[model samples]
Target: MIREAIEAFASRSPSRFAILVFAAIIALFTILLSLPAASADGTATNFPDAFFTATSMVCVAGLTTVDMATHWSPLGNAFVFLATQIGALGVLTLASILGAIIAGRLGLRARLMAASDTNPLRLHAGPVAEGQAIRLGEIGGLLATVAISALVIEVGVAIAVLPSVLATGYGLAESLWYSIFYSAMAFTNTGVTPNVEGLTPFAHDYWFLLMLMFGVTLGSIGFPVLYALSRNFRRRAKWSLHVKLTIVAWSALWILGTIAFLLLEQSNGATFRNMNPGEQVFQSGFMSTMARSGGFALIPTSELDSASLFLTDMLMFIGGGSASTAGGIKVTTIAVLLLAAFAEARGRSSIEIFQRRIPGDVLRLAVSVLLWGAVTVALATIVLLTMTDAPFEFVLFDVISGFGTVGLSTGVTANLPDPGVYLMALVMFMGRVGTVTLAAALAVTQKGQLFTRPEERPIVG
Candidate 1:
């Protein structure tokens, strides 16, 4: 039956029929958690929390409706860990590539499967004559990016964080595990740290903070963007528009967001009240980056002043860049939206960038993505606030953070009612699966597919 479903999905379905595979991957972990031995405390669990974790995993959203590091058994935790790995790598269509490679089944279906992964918005080509090709090398490169990036950053974090964990007097192996767990915890932005009090214990520890900040920030910026940048650092002209836009917008936002945090929290401070200038800047800068869907924290969210928390919420809502590890609407999409607005302001008919015109279809899709993402985030935020005692702003912050897969919270995640966790898990699912794919699924099609409309005028200020 599963085989039949795969065949049907491969041949003809919603382009995002691929996402259903992600749903199953989410379900598998839930099943793992539901098993009698899944919980260390031997508590018989309902399927809801387990399902929530599954969605969280596949969506790459890290809200654990339950206490993850302690509540679940080792095996259960292992399943969650693997799910994070899959989600971090591409959750929807990428699995088919893995399944085929492992089974040695490179049939026509496999070829067609590979095609979907490499679509390019090549405006220079005028029209795409064919679907973009996907290569084994490219697929391997993606996996390698996720694996190597995760390892180097995670392992380095483990080593870097050792002094702090060791201060707890854990044995070598146990400290080793904590180090390893925190690495995964930070990078995956899963928020399920082995650290007893999460980042609370490491709040003022610089090296520990640095390790997590890097892990979460780098891991969220989808590897594709990084790969392009790493290879094209010397030639700005050769860089894809996507790469250029991502870096420009991300850098701008990070700088601006950092300042917002510092200004908002500087003097009213619980955490920052007595800190020197340099420490305050570092803390604000790091936390703002984490807010860009990284989810790491050098300071407790609870200690943040109300104004600072609002700034964090804005950062979380904006999230990270596209085709990158980060979530939210993506920096590139946001840039495109702003560029489109600018074009209109200047009385231009088409959105152009770096001297090249962005096709109307791409702009429309970008708008659609942001539009749907805004709606989803809004609805999710409302649901969370209704279900919990947390302040409206904090819940909105958590919702965006989770949806962006930025796992930072206002210290309220552990105390949420089951309904609250479930709402958050759903938001995370939408965020991670991505707004574009979700929008595509709902769209009315030409011959049942969406089509570009000719430019039209509407009144605007």
Candidate 2:
């Protein structure tokens, strides 16, 4: 009877099921974290702090009102690590994974639930095309890939960063644990540092920073792209348009952000002024990479110039790829909108990319995502501004960070009042689950119209 109820709920609304699952996880973690056993000083954490931390962890957003390295005890850290792993896998995907393990196979309903995480259209009441991110038949393989690839890459990263940690005068066991923690946080793009000093010690360690960057980039590029690349790495011509657009747009944004930071922050004494040209360039690259959902920082975000801060805001707002650990509207959405604009400029009616035509529905979805994301950030910013006396730039930056789940903050998040913290938590939740998924969850049902009204042309801009 219980199983039948769950099945009915999932069938009626997969998106709502996903949201409920995430909410339940956050609640569980909040309870665990609020316990005195989770704190370093053996005092119960206040409800607001505990709830916010749990939300950030479950959302894989690194924003925190507390010092992560010192505030959590070993058990609390364990809870955090587990939350990030579950969050990185996503609510529906993780549920499907457990369901598969329990049943030894996935049913059609299970596939539909998991597929909704990769492709939101699966939540709608219609047949989804095979050409979408991951087809129904391939969901099982995608799930395996999601689990296996995450483990392998994180292990590889830990191994790669171990030597650096050892060079810093740490014992073998401690070094190993720190390396593992860094690996998980970096690959998951949670951005929480294990060390209290954060990334300062490794600021000049190019190799270590580069390994973290590689992990962040891989994790940010969505699982579908990873699955596609794993199968078609040798045949570039066979790459799907989604994979191609993701790679092209992500790379382009990374380069642009790096150049922008280098030029804008080179003369700022607080960040890049003291560093030599080479050091400045390398640090700029690192900052640019981290701004895209990897939250590790060598310097405080408050030290950046206004222009650099604005640029970081843009990077955080656009964020990484869709259906990945990263947040924001997604790189693919921006890519689609750009393609549409180009088509319009060329006097073409249809959007085409990589010699493939994009459907009208995709463009519509992209527009919706963009608008929803902007509105979410705007509303959150307004609320936060009213709640605090912080500068507009800082408030907007933190709001976007929460919305993008990018985890970078200008010290605004740590000082927010309880009410503001709750609001930010809500933003992170919406940002992580995605605006489309939230919209689908709120919708009672999808209706179809049989009759069409006559279309009329309106005045243009």
Candidate 3:
């Protein structure tokens, strides 16, 4: 009966399952965290703080109303780590894995839901195999591969960082633990640090920062890209245009952001004044990469120059790739939009990339995602500005950070009023699922036009 109900509910719509899965995880964590045992002093965590923390962790946003180090007990931290892992893996993917494990099979509706929840864009790009049910063995195999690959990457990163952590004067056991925690946090792009100073001590440590940067980049580059690269390594398979576009866009954005940060913050006494040239370059690169939904910061976000902050806001909005742990409008969406603009500027009728023409629907969807994201952030900025006396820049930064799931803040998160916290929480939720998916989830039902209307043109800008 329980399984039947789940199947029925999942059949209703993919968004329902995705939303419910995240909702369940958040609720469970919220209850667990609200217990007195979850706190350091044995005092119960208030509902507001618990809810906000739980939402942030489950969404992998990493924003905190209270410090994890000072306020939360070991048990609470464990809960947060688990929730972050779940969020990073994705609610739908994890849920499907669990279902496959327990039932030894996934129903047709379950597979469809899993696919839709993880990559709805794929469904749009291709047709589902007609009258063919997805095999349970196939899903189980894929799930196993993804899970083992992720574990291996994370564990390898931990081992690599362990020595550097010990060099910092941390005790052996503590260093080992911290290395593992940092590896997990980096790969998940949660940006939450168990360390009190939040990675500040190792800002100039080459090995530590490099390893973390690699981990963050690998995780946020999207799993599909990784899988494709892996397959190509073994079989020399042809690369899809999607894979090419993602890599190109990701690399371009990282380079552009790094240069922008370096130029903007070169003379900012608070951040880059004392740093040596090499250290500044590394820090600038790290910040550039992290700003695009990785969430780690070497320099204090508050100390960044206005230009650097504004540039960061744009990077955070563009975000990482689709179907990855990272959030924002996604690299592919930005790439598509840019391609469209370039095509229009060249007086071309179709947007062509790598000799492939982008479908009209795909372009439309990309525009919708970008527009919706902008509107959401704008509205959030207005709300935060009206509710608090915080600076406009800080409020705007916080809003975009939440919506990007990047977790970088300008020191305003902890002081936000209750209403503001809740508002940010909502933004985090939407971001985790994605602006497009959230829009789909809120839709009443899927409907298509039965007849075409005559096309008309409106006045141009």
Candidate 4:
């Protein structure tokens, strides 16, 4: 009956179909997480807590309803591992496995139509010769690369950290399991770990934190950039146009983010009192980059000045890049928006970047996506602030973190009161599913005929 229902639903609108599949995955996760395998006493699990975990897992947002280490048994931890994998792969991508098979049997033309409908931009490019093949290869190759890269790093970390674990004189089994889970969480940016301290024991250490941060940076750079990098290095080819734009935008955002946070927080006694100038700079830059993607914290995030909070939020909103593990509006979207704003200021008709004019359709997409992101953030902030008595800055920080899929927090999420949880959950949902998908689902396509009308501008800015 469920299969019949799915088939029936898929026959209608595929976007809705995609949503339904995601819902099923959410249900699966909820059931697994809600299991009461932990033998700990004086603790009880509730629907809200489990449901919240399910949402966080499926979204890959890393916000938690329970202390993961204490609340979950080994089996429960294992479930979390699988949940992260599913969440990282994304329901849409996994759903495509089935969708593609069906579409293929339906014929290449039908498959192309389905693919084109799913991603509207592909259709606008004058129908490339091997569009479907390219899309399929890109999507599959990207996820496979992420999975493989994550495992490689995680295994390496496991081996390197094993000596430390062995020095503790514990059995190898416990150490091995903890190492595996910790590496997976860190690399995937899930932020949930078997360790109670959650990366604090290695806090001041250089290599340990660097490895986690590096994994996260790679994860957040988006699959498109990764694929481009791979092809460039492998084939000895020049970097593609997309790769250049992504690299430039990503570097600029982080450099500015690090500098902005350093200036904002250094003078503040709460954040920089104990650290020397060099340590302050290192901590600030590391914190800034990690906040954009990785959740690991070397210093206390709660004590940062208001300016630091605002800067972090801005970085989170811009996020990493599309098809990357990170969320937010993404680097390219913000880049396009920045150029658009510049063009408007210069009284230009179209936005241009890197001396190349952005096509009208691309500009429209950027504007549409950015509008939704702004509105969503505004709504989330308003709703979040109204319900909770927590400081507005803290809530805003977490909101951005949740939306960016960056797991770093200001310690505000642990005991979210009432509507705050719901608001953050919605923001995470938007971050995970993406504003583009939401916009496309609701966007109305208009038809232009032979009849035309003259336009007159009404007001000046």
Candidate 5:
């Protein structure tokens, strides 16, 4: 009976089904984390902390109320690792993958649902272009790419960082565990360090940080981009417009962020002031990369200048690519919006990028995502501000961090009251699943009108 009900729901709305699955997973992990075996001291954790940690893990948000390395038992760490891997697969994609595995093939409904994850326009009533992202017929291949690429990349990163872990004076077994944990966290963009010192030990280890940056970049680029690049690594001309735009926008943001950090934080003694020129550039690059959903922090976020914090907030809010493990409104949304603005400025009737025209629907969708994300962040920030006496900058930083699932906090998240904690968890969930998905889930149906209303223009801004 339960299976029947689930099938009914899945058929009705993939967005809601995905939300339900994520909520269920978070709940299960919360219960597991609350158990005595999940803690280091053999005592059951409190409800608030356990629930928040579980939500962070399942959302891949990485914000924690408790000390991650010292508070969790080996068993608890195992649970977290598993939860992050699941979270990285994404809710809808995971469901479709599981269904395909069980049935030995993806059904029509399953394919449609999974395709929606890649191209959200598929969720609404519309005719989505076959060349947009992943086609419905290619859903099986996309799922395979998602699973296989994640495994290969994580394993490769783990092997590359294993030597570094061993150099830290840990035994082979413990080193192996830490390497795998860090690899998983890096590739998933979860940023939850397995050690209490976090990235302190590896702050100067260029090789270790580079490997993590590589893993995080791959993870944040979105599975669709990976799938496309794998098939057309040498054939740039064959790349789809979506792939082109995502790559271009992502690279631009990374470069701009690096420059911004370099200029803004160079004089700040706590972060970049003491570093030599070369090291400063490298660390700035790392910080820029991490700001866009990588989440690992070498420097103290609380010590950053207000200007740098605000810049980091923007980077975190933009987050990573669409349909990626990373969060926020997505780079593509911003890219589309930017392209639309440029088109408007040029008095072009249509938005074009990479020599391909973008339909109005895509622009509308991008605007909707940006607005919804901004609203979500603003609302969360307001509620959090009211909940705590923390400074506005710190509150805003943590709120955007939660909303982006970027996990770089100004030490404010750990001190949030229970109400704020719950609110942040909800923000994380919304961020992970996406505002579009949530909106679609709430919507009853998309009504199609056969006739159009008379055109009217209101007063312009």
Candidate 6:
């Protein structure tokens, strides 16, 4: 009976099915988290706080209404860690695995569903393209590759992080636990730390921060990108345009963001004032990396100057790569928009990059994603401002961070009322799964017009 229900649910449009799965998982976790055993004080948590935390965990957004180190018990922490993994793996990946297990083989419908959810770019490539055929095999291999790759990377990072954690004078068991927890959070890009101050204590520890940066970078780069690299490492096969663009955009954002942060925050006494040149350079780079869809912070965001906060908002809004643990409108969407503008400036009819023409459908999808994301963030901001005393800038920061699934906060998250907290959760869920899936789902429903209407011109700027 249960199998029948799952198969039926899986048969829906990929975006709707994906959203349903995420919502169901979040609901289950909310119930588990609201239990007395999930709290440190041996009392049941209020529904709003529990639901918010559960949403954050399952969305991999890392925004918290409660303190991570002090509020929850070991069982709660375990639940959070597990949810982070599940969220990062995503509903589509898990569903693919389960569907294969239940049916004893992956059907064409199931493959298309998983592919559409995880690698929507393939769908954009159209039906007769090699990408569509490749995706069928890719999804099957992705299940094992994603799970094993994440596990191995997390374990390796944990081992590297253990010595630093132990040197802080924690006992062996405690140090090991911290190591594992940090590893999971960093790799999953959830950014939930075992310490209340996050990575502040280890801010100067370059080695520790390096491992985390490595893990987060690898995780947010998208599984398809990584899989392509692994599969084509020694071969003469050409990398797909999607993989190439993702890598280029990913690198460009990190560099540009680092430079922007360094310049903007250089004079902020509360942030970079005490740090020397080398420390400043490293911290700026780290923060820039984290701002792009990473959840942890080494410095208090509230202390940064207004310009820096605004800059951080932009980076958070851009987020990380597509079809990965990271969220946001995606770098590819940004790339498409920029390329379109560039093409228009050159009086070209079609945007061309790397000898490939950008599809009109893809451009339309990009526009839709940008528009929806902006609207979602704006609506959340308006609601939070009305409900809480936080300034518009801080509220906007929280909203973009939630929408981008980048968990950095300006110390306003925990102070919000119940309505504000739920609003943030809605934005986070929408940011993580809702926007991307919704965009793709909407795109699939669009049919090319067979009949033409009279063309009209509107006044332009």
TM-score of each: 0.86, 0.98, 0.94, 0.86, 0.98, 0.94
Residue 93 in candidate 6, Cα distance off native in Å = 2.5
How many residue pairs of model 4 clash at the backbone? 1
The order by descending lDDT is: 5, 2, 6, 3, 1, 4
* Model 2 misplaced regions, further than 4 Å: 98-104
lDDT tens digits by residue: candidate 4, 195-293:
777666665665655666676777677655666676666652455545666778988988888788778876788777777888777777787777775
In candidate 2, what are the lDDT values of residues 1-461, reduced to their tens digit? Answer: 76667767776777787788889899999999999999999999999999999999999999999999999999999999999998999767876665555455797877987887777767774458757488888898999899888999999999999999999888999889889999999888899987877787787788999999999999999999999999989998878788888999999999999999999997898988888999988988899989999988887899899999999999999999877899988899999999999999999999997789998888888999999999999999998999889999999999999999989999999999999999999999999988988998899888889999999999998
Tally clashing residue pairs in candidate 3. Answer: 0
- lDDT (Cα) of model 3: 0.80
Alpha-carbon runs more than 4 Å astray in model 1: 1-5, 98-140, 151-153, 411-416, 442-458
Provide the clashing-pair count of each candidate structure: 9, 0, 0, 1, 0, 0
Q: Which lDDT tens digits does candidate 6 get at residues 1-461?
A: 98877777666455566677788899999999999999999899999999999999988998899998999999999989989999998666665656777777888656765675555654444332545113676777866678888999999999999999988778999899999999988888888988766677787788999999988898888877777777886662477777778889989999998998889888888888888998889988999889987777888888888988998898888888777888888888899999999999999999888888877878887887899999999888887888888888998998998898888898788899887888899899888774656655555464677999999999998
Q: In lDDT terms, how accurate is model 2?
A: 0.89
* Pairs of residues at least 3 apart in sequence or in different chains that clash in candidate 6: none
How high is the CA lDDT of each candidate model? 0.69, 0.89, 0.80, 0.68, 0.90, 0.82
Measured with C-alpha atoms, the lDDT of residue 52 in candidate 6 is 96
Per-residue alpha-carbon lDDT of model 1 for 26-130, expressed as tens digits?
A: 777788778868787777567778887777766666766677767788777677778776777664336546556544665544433333333323211112433
Query: For residues 203-264, what per-residue lDDT tens digits would candidate 3 score against the true structure?
Result: 66788888888888988887666666765655533666667788899999999998888888
- What is candidate 4's CA lDDT for residue 309? 77
RMSD of each candidate relative to the true structure: 3.8, 1.3, 2.8, 3.7, 1.2, 2.3
Please list all clashing residue pairs in model 4, or write none if there are none: 222-324
Error of 1 at 375 (Å): 1.0
Clashing pairs in 5: none
After aligning candidate 6 to the native by TM-score, how far in Å is the CA of 10 from where it should be? 2.5
